[model samples]
Target: MIYVEGGSFDMGYQRGRDGADNDDVKNAKPLHKVTLHSFYIGKFQVTQEQYYAVMDKDSNSHFKGDRLPVETISWEEAKVFIERINQKTGKKFRLPTEAE
Candidate 1:
């Protein structure tokens, strides 16, 4: 895990010809500032092998490599895996929120 120093920043971009082209960027809206608190985050995306170690199940990725990020898991499965890992490590482990 990496420790992130907290700070405040504007969350959205200005709307104009010079702004982001994608419509999805509009979801950021109102150009408001947000404050964050110090928190720990994974240094890298979780790997297939790491997921397998925690969950004791194959990641089932077609790529099939230890270094590759695990993908295509349902939310419920991920929650269960996180719970199991928390139990084993005796520490809280959770997915990052969008604002983080």
Candidate 2:
């Protein structure tokens, strides 16, 4: 895990036609500011072996490799995995929000 010293910053783009063609980018208008609190996040994505160590099951990634990042898991499944891991390790862990 890596410690992130959080702070505030402006988020989103200005509301105007300035070559942002994508709907997603256009919608990111009305620029806003956001603040975040310091937190810890994994330095690397969870690998197949790491997931298996905690969940006691194969991730079933198409390209199977113990060192590869686990894939094909739903949000709920990830939450359950985190819950189980926290129980086993006695540490609080959660997925980062969109802003984070």
Candidate 3:
């Protein structure tokens, strides 16, 4: 895990920029600031092996490899996995929010 010292930063794009016609950018108008609290995040993505160790079941990832990142899981499944792993390890773990 890596410790991230949190701070505030400007988020979203400015109103005028070349090639900003896309809807995604349009929705991001009116620059805003976001503040975040310090937190720890995994240095690497969750691997199949780690998921298997925690969940006690095959992840059924499209590409089969112990070191590869786990995929094809829904948000609910990930929450359940985190809950179970927290129970096993006595550590609080959760998914990061979009701003995070």
Which is the leading candidate under lDDT?
Answer: 3
The lDDT of model 1 is 0.84
Segments of candidate 2 deviating more than 4 angstroms: 26-29
lDDT of model 1, residue 17? 37
All models: lDDT? Answer: 0.84, 0.87, 0.88
33-69, model 1: which lDDT tens digit per residue? 9899999999998899999999889878777799898
Model 2 CA lDDT for position 42:
94
Model 2: which residue pairs collide?
none
> For residues 17-86, could you state the per-residue lDDT of candidate 2 as single tens digits?
4455678785674668999999989999999999999999998888899999988888998999999999
TM-score of each: 0.80, 0.85, 0.85
Superposed by TM-score, candidate 2 places the C-alpha of residue 34 at a distance from the truth, in angstroms, of 0.6
> What shift in Å separates residue 38 of candidate 3 from its native position after superposition?
1.3
Candidate 1 stretches greater than 4 Å from native: 17-22
Clashing pairs in 3: none
Backbone clash pairs for candidate 1 read none
Q: Which ten residues in a row have the lowest lDDT in candidate 1?
A: 12-21
Query: Poorest 10 consecutive residues of model 2 by lDDT?
Result: 13-22
